[model samples]
Target: MGIRTKLKRNRTQKKGMPPGSLVYIGDEQTEEVTVSAIAFDSHGMEEFEDVSIDKIKTLIDSDQVAWINVNGVHNVQLVDQISKKLGLHPLTTEDILNTDHRPKIDFFEDHLLSIVKMLDLSAESTDLDIEQVSFILMENTVVTFQEKRGDLFDPVRLQLQESKGRIRKSGADFLYYSLLDVIFDQYLIIMDEMDDRIAELEGMIMEDPDNHSLQDINQYKNTILQLKKTVWPVREVVNKLINRKVPYIKEDISFYLQDIHDHIVQANDMVETSRGQLYGLLDVYYSSLSMKMNEIMKVLTIVSTIFIPLTFIAGIYGMNFTNMPELSWDWSYPAVWIVMIIITGLMLVYFKRKNWF
Candidate 1:
């Protein structure tokens, strides 16, 4: 299913149903679920794949930190079993399936659930593609759920692979910070993409604003609106997490979270500025089209104005009055021609003086 269809389905499925219904309201994917686990401490690391839920639990029961990433959450049964095993709230499981959620953080007694929207431009069509990513932070476990596998977290994984950073030494809270850092870092990429698109539109507007410019502006405006829906609330999520004052989340990671918050604010500002640019572009597009129409109308009006008196002069001569003296005179035709030429010349001079052209 398409993203728009997923959105409609989310709304439709909720109707006539009780609140907190667990429905997988998103794009249907037949992709097999892939679970990758990595347990690492300062000493070393253990990474594996296809680990069962019970095995993950056994791994979590150990002293080392376990990072189990579950890619493809469309399998409702698997998600339910995993959530049940992790003691996740039913609403949290619903949120995991329902991927239209804004960036938010919900706290529980034993664990913390943080939900965020991941953004990407579709390579095939240049359309914005959005996905929801949920993170569960427990004592020794950090479980990440993605609707589909994405390389956005590759850098974090690479850090683990190279043993180049403190990730190997970090606890579950630090892992949470690292994963969130990766997620919010994507906003920078998204903002840059928006900037490039806005610049392209500006060039088009300045060079050749046409009917399509309005259409493109409207499309971009809608894109910005959708982006604002994701980026702005992220600021709240960042701020709340930064000031959460929870025991599970470490104070030393506060600086890193603060940096993420700053980046989120920057992303929000860019969205607002870009939205303003879009509105301004819309106005400019209308003004450009109006000027174009005015130019055409001006030329037509000038032609009609020049013909009005000429029509009247021809009409006067066209009259078939029986007693008209000029009709019988030999020079009457030439004389009428001279009079019309003079009238036309005077009218041209008047138009020139008024700068009607």
Candidate 2:
């Protein structure tokens, strides 16, 4: 379904409900919710393909840092169950279920909640694939909730598996930073794609500006607007994280979050640049239309001006008066033909000199 229709239906479903109500406000899905976890510390790492509530509680209470990933959030009962077990706030659960929530950070007493939009450009086209991803960070555990199964976090997972860099030795906060970093990296990729698309549109506009170009420009404008909306708030979220807004985030993790902050700022700049270019392209398209119109009008005016004198000459000679002198001359027809030819040639030369066509 289209986003607008889904939003309208989402509102209708939640109209009379109280705040913090858990309502699944996204596309309809019947896939069962699946939970997977990876727990690691300096000693060793463990993977859980299917984790239960007891397993989660055990990992959270133990010394090892745990990362629990939930694939689907459409199951309200499953979400509430996990949230209650993890001591997540009611509003956090509500936001998780409401996939339309903006990218933001919510601080609670026990855990910190972060909601971010994950976007990817489809391989087949420039259209974006977007989903809401929510994170709940606690002392030694980070829980992630997604609308569906696939995501861009595979790189982060690979790092954890290979014991690469400082991820294995760091706390849950560092892992959280790694995930956010992955999201921002995708943003950079998207920026590149946007640049390529703008260049393509620019070339099309310059070569052959048509109604299709206008329509494509408009569609891309909306796409870039959505990108801006998703990216702009993420910068604020990263800033808040860097400013020590969340207690769970440690001092060392702040430095890494700064990198994400820089990346997001760069993404924001790219978004703004794309927006300006799209506006300029729109102006070019309009100017092209106007120039075409002016060419047509100029040609019609020149043709009419040349025909005026020829028509007047013909009218004068074809008068019904019997005293017309040209009618009695034997060479009148040839003389008139030569005069008309000379007038046509002179008019053509004059127009050529004026560069009217």
* Model 2: residues with Cα > 4 Å off, grouped in runs: 42-44, 123-126, 245-247, 314-338
Q: How close is candidate 2 to the true structure, as a TM-score?
A: 0.89
Error of 2 at 148 (Å): 0.7
Top TM-score model: 2
Candidate 2 lDDT tens digits, 1-357: 576797779779888989998888888778889999999997779899878988888988988899999999999999999999998878889889988888999777768899999999866665888899999999899999999999999998888899989999999999999998998999999989889988988988877788999888988898899899899999888887788556677777777888999999999999999999999999988888788888889989988988888998899987869888889899999999888889988998999998887
RMSD of each: 3.5, 2.6
Over the stretch 175-276, how does candidate 1's per-residue lDDT look in tens digits?
A: 888888887788888778878888888888877788787888888788889889988888888888888888778889898889999989988898889999
Compute the lDDT for candidate 2. Answer: 0.89
lDDT score of residue 80 within candidate 2: 96
TM-scores of all predicted structures: 0.83, 0.89
Task: Give candidate 1's whole-model lDDT.
Answer: 0.84
Off by over 4 Å in 1: 1-21, 123-126, 307-357
